[model samples]
Target: MDLVAINLIDGLFYGLLLFMLSAGLTLIFSMMGILNFAHASFYMLGAYFAYQISLYLGFWAGLLIAPPLVGVLGALIERYGLRRVHQFGHVPELVFTFGLAWLIEEVVKFIWGNNMMAYQEPEILKFALFHIGSNSIQAYKVFMIFTSMAIFIGLLFILTRTRIGLIIQAALSYPKTVEALGHNVPLIFMGVFGVGTALAGVAGVLAGPSLGTFPGMAVVLGSIVFVTIVIGGLGSLWGALIASLLIGWMTTAAASSSFQFATLLEFFGMTPPADLDESYLRDLWTLSLPQIGPILPYIFMILILVLRPYGLFGKRDA
Candidate 1:
């Protein structure tokens, strides 16, 4: 029970991290209808940028500096690269981002090298808060959860209460109408895209130390983030929140479990052929969530697509 509780806590933290990355992607996609494949690459950039900034300014400062830097970069990409490709349609926009992802990874490798960069947690947040029964919970994880919740609330307020948020919300629902209302629709789109990418960068900064800072980090987490957005629903923030939490808990629970399908098979009087290697069956039976964390969201995404084509909360047509 303590173990389960620990796993749940850990998973909730993980989910918050995912939310940070996915929320921006969801906002951009929901508002602009463009799927930016380089979103995760921006996350990787954030970690790298934060690491660089932290060397001089400390972790908290890096958190502040890295996100805005990434946001500026995102804005540049949208204004110059994505905007140039916009005329060709969504495919070209996606392709541009895909290529951009490749370029960013190469650039990162060129500057940081192929080896993993050492990123340490800040001294202020390095302690464990307390123990649940026998399992200890780290203060850093608690910080992450609170930070994520804070971001979520801030974003909600921006979207629902602020004037710019109102315009963005209106544009999302009816872009043509918003444009007709004498608003600068294109600029709004660009700003939202930049903000969205900035959010991902912030997530990268926060998650960098634990997730590792490496050139391959983008490749490692890129698809899973996309799967999360898809599974949650493309344009729905609520869907993304629920999906992130669900995936986080599911992955953690799977990673912590000890039961194997082989044990169940034995209980049911079933056995693999004597000639066949039982190792394969054992591997299957012993599968755990953390081991398959990246793929789980994809599986869930497919299931969601089949059952709810629009998404768990998505209203847009496929």
Candidate 2:
């Protein structure tokens, strides 16, 4: 029971972290119809930026300052780099963003080197909030949970209840109509792109200490972020939240489980050969849930795509 509780909490934390990254990507895709392949790169930038800022001003200050900086950079990229390529269609946009991702990764390596930075959670949050059996739940994990939940609630309110939200949504389907109403449609695009990247930056800041601030951090989570948004349905915020939680819990539970493939095979009336090395099913016989935990999300993604091409919450038009 204690182990289950621990896994649940851990899964929730991880799910929210993925949501922070995926939300922005989802938003960008919904508005601009651009996937923004470099989204995770911005996430990496956030961590590195926070790490540097934390050195001078502390974690709280870094938390406040770093995301805005990343947002501004994203805005500039939209205004200059992405904007120039926008006229060329999505292929150009994708290629540009893909190259940009590589550029950002190289730049990070050049600036921060290949080692993990000394980034850590604030000292005030270092203590355990509580414990389950021998497992301790730190204050930092709780903080991250509340913080992510707050972000989700705040975004939901803004997108569904606010006038600006209506305008943003309208612009997606009727840009000319929105522009005719005196809204700077292009500016809206830039802002949405900026905001999306900024959300990624925020994820980086929060995850930096817990996951480690390293150059390869973006690459590590990049593909998974796409899987998250896809499984959640491309543009659905609620879908993102649900899928994130599902993945978080699934991966966490699998990692903590001792269940084996051999057991599963036996349950299905299959038996492994005594000379396992010569058997075709040797690998399957030796496999354990924990060994495949990391790839579970990908497996889940394939299933989701196979069953629902538009995703769980995505529209056919989307």
Candidate 3:
């Protein structure tokens, strides 16, 4: 059905957005053991930075330049800030990044004002790319899908085939050993952190149009990114990808469904309350899937943690 098709496409787009953010977190928090609470801050920067750059350069230039700039900032943070805290263990690193997240938010509010900006898609991509029955799909959404796929493919090639990726992977397991082998492990960590944050930046740039560009945008997305990587499994690249898509589809499905708790109550052989407003559980019984769609991923995450502990594709429990 057209409805199913639309949901699938929408889910893929949402999933890819999550992937862009979660992919970086997996590399940083999962693979590299860096608790980067500020990762989504970089994502927020991307939208704001792109908005500023796009004012002078154009959307294409913003798309090209903003992420690298954000990446450089991330690398700088890793090199100067996070590296200094490394001696104190992950607790300090987490605390540092957590503080840094709030710091970035304050800086953004100072620079951009505490309001959402009009970060629209380019004129070229404003039209519909295709249609499903009566529904027209925006060209921008199609562009996002392809762009995310390209990034995923490029990243896969880099990690599996490239020399830098091999070195990075080696450093993930044995930083001291890699350093002993004459590789600059610290530089690798910086590079990984930079790239990871760059990916988040890309997501921010792409999502700003629909998600709204604001200082608090990062806060809205930050926890979801962690849930995604956790549900996917720590230290597992493929796990992140699977979990991102799964959550995306699940969310889209829930949002589009008409199902409510009342439906479930009937299946359980319970009579509907004659005066719903008077019932103590009126809200619970009347709640539709779409009403709780945003938190559905978290619910599923809790279930995964309770049932599987290690996630669908996790190698080991943390």
Model 3 ranges off by over 4 Å: none
| Per-residue lDDT over 146-200 for candidate 2, one digit per residue giving the tens place of the 0 to 100 score | 9999999999998889998999989978999999999999999999898888999
What is the lDDT ranking, best to worst?
2, 3, 1
The candidate scoring highest on TM-score is: 2
* Model 1 lDDT tens row, 1-318: 788789889989989999898999999998878888999999999999999999988999999899999999998888888888989899888888899999999999999999988887899889889999977788888988898999999999998899999999999989999999999998998898899899999999999998899999988888888888898889788888988999899878877776566666678887655644556565656554457655666788889889988888888674
lDDT of 3 at 177: 90
What's the ranking of the predictions by TM-score, best on top?
Answer: 2, 3, 1
lDDT per residue for candidate 3 within 1-318, as digits (tens), equals 999999999999999999999989998875568768998999999998898899999899999999999999999989999999999898998899999999999999998898789998999999988889989999999999999999999999999999988988888777899999999888888898999999999998999887899988999999998999889988778888999999999999999999988888888898888999898879878889899999989998999999988887877645
Write down the TM-score for model 1. 0.94
lDDT of each: 0.87, 0.94, 0.90
User: Which 10-residue window of candidate 1 scores lowest in summed lDDT?
Assistant: 271-280
- The collision pairs in model 2 are none
> Comparing 1 and 3 by TM-score, which wins?
3
Model 2 collision count? 0
Better of 1 and 3 by lDDT: 3
